[model samples]
Target: MSGTEALIEAAKKRAAYAAVDEFIRDGMKVGVGSGSTVVYVVERLVQRKNEEGLNITCIPTSFQSLNLINDGGLNLGDLNRHAPLDVSIDGADECDEKLNLIKGAALTLEKINVFNSKLFVVVADYRKESKVLGQKWKKGVPIEVLPLAWRAVSNYIVEHLHGKPILRMAVAKAGPVVTDNGNFILDVDFGEMADPLKVLTDVNRIPGVLETGLFVDMVEKAFFGTADGGYVTVDRKGERKVFQ
Candidate 1:
């Protein structure tokens, strides 16, 4: 890997390990989020379980996460049966100063996991941090929509919200990218978003929309791994705590 890629990978591991070590407890129900950074979280959790004999049930946000949990040798349970989780640890595509997150992939399931968790912790590398939402990750918001209503939803976002919405195309498949829920994804760009909460509400109000990537006011704490081999925790109250 390149130097920058190596740094990012190190940061991801540092942040993930920190979040797991700080929040996880024995016998608690945990919620695991998806994406690359979260892979480290699961790895650390499995290590703790094996070494310290930590007994915890994990709730996965997607099929990928479920596999990660199983492969990590951690106990897995469905959200429907085990919700109101003690804590949730996941990664973000981008996060603003206030801890508002822009999560990519499995947006709907991640939302449900965060909503059901009492303590929601986000983990990411330094590159994912920004002074404002959409500053770092500019790929736009990933909105999950029903397959049949995707065109209508795209048009509505353009005409009503004055945003550019594009259906996510699959790399392996022939057509649009279908989500795990058998739905479509629309990555909408609204430029620099000043009001993420309002944007999230407006987008979800559109017909056939399942969920948006904008995770507003759901995060309690965010752990950002610095390229310099350290980690910083930003709480909901905007307090910064650094750890090496």
Candidate 2:
């Protein structure tokens, strides 16, 4: 693999380690998030489930994540019944200097992921920048909305919210893109948001907006794999340390 790819692989491994160390507990309910980086966490959890006999239930952020949990031999549960998860493992598109994050893979997967978890852990490679949430990730923010109010939501995002939003189109198909929540998605770009938390609050206040990808203060900790074959962790308190 190339250098960046190797870093990503290493990051995945470290993320798995972090998840196994902190998130996994005997008989605890865990939340699994969608994305490439979270895949390794599921794999590690599965091994622990078999070898260590950890009896943990997992709630998935998406259908794809649900499959990962099931294939890993972890029990699956719906969020409706399993409120207040013990921990959640996820990946971010970019993390700022303060460890705040910008997520969603050109889609609104971040919404349901954040909603179901209590302690959200972000895992990423070193290349995931620590500048500002929007600086590194130029892709528009992902917004999930009610299907009935997509038009109103889109207009609000563009006109009222001061965003440049486009109806997400599916490259694989000929129709509008659909999210795991069975809702339509809008890719919105606000261009270097000065205050992400305020922007997030404003967007959420809209009638049809279910959630936006600008996650502010939701993450409790972050684990980043560096090129030097080591991992670094940043807690919500802004404390930084290296992890083996």
Candidate 3:
């Protein structure tokens, strides 16, 4: 890997470890989110579960996370038992100053985990920090749509929302990337978003658009592992705390 790539990966590990250490505890029902950074979070959870004997049940937000929880030896939980989670720890593609997030997915499934959790915390490397929604993460907002509705949703986003929706293609596969719910994802370029919540509402109004990537006012705290090996946190109060 390139030097910069190595640094970012290390940073992700640091952020993931720190977040899991602070938030998870015995008897807590935690929501495990998706993405590369969350991989480290699961690793730390496994360590704590085995070494410290931490008793916790994990609710996965994605198929990948479900596998991680199962393979890591953490107890798996469903919505019925763990809906009101102590906390949900997730990774952001881009987190703006207000802690709004982008890079969306699994419409109903992820939201099931998100809204049910009491506190939602985000973890990421420095590369994901942004002053606004579209600043750092160039990939447009991901919008999940029903398989049959993909074309119409894409067209609506362009004509009404004034956005370009690109069908996300699979890397190793032949067709479009199918979501866990068997839906299609359209990475819609809304340009630099002015108001994330507004964007979310406007996009959802489009028929067939299940959910927009925009996460507005849902974050309680965000832990960022900086490129220089320092850690910082942005809290709900919009305050930055550096761990020295």
- Whole-model Cα lDDT of every candidate shown, in order: 0.91, 0.78, 0.85
Residue range with the least summed lDDT across 10 consecutive positions in model 3: 103-112
lDDT of 2 at 244: 57
User: Which residue pairs show collisions in model 1?
Assistant: none
83: Cα error in model 2, Å: 1.5
- In candidate 2, what residue range of length 10 has the lowest lDDT sum? 105-114
The candidate maximizing lDDT is: 1
Scored by lDDT, model 1 comes in at 0.91
* lDDT tens readout by residue for model 1, 1-244: 9887787789789989988998999999999999998899999999998899999999998998999999988999878889889999999999999899898879899999999999999999888889988787889999999999999999999999988998999998799998889999999988878899889989989989999999999898999988777888999999998877
Query: Which model, 2 or 3, shows the larger lDDT?
Result: 3
- Compare candidates 1 and 2 on TM-score and give the better one: 1
Which residue pairs overlap in candidate 2's backbone?
none
| Top-down TM-score ranking | 1, 3, 2
State every prediction's TM-score relative to the real structure.
0.98, 0.90, 0.95
lDDT of 1 at 78: 76
lDDT of candidate 2 at residue 69, scale 0 to 100: 88
lDDT preference between candidates 1 and 2, better one: 1
- Report how far off residue 95 is in candidate 3 (Å): 0.2
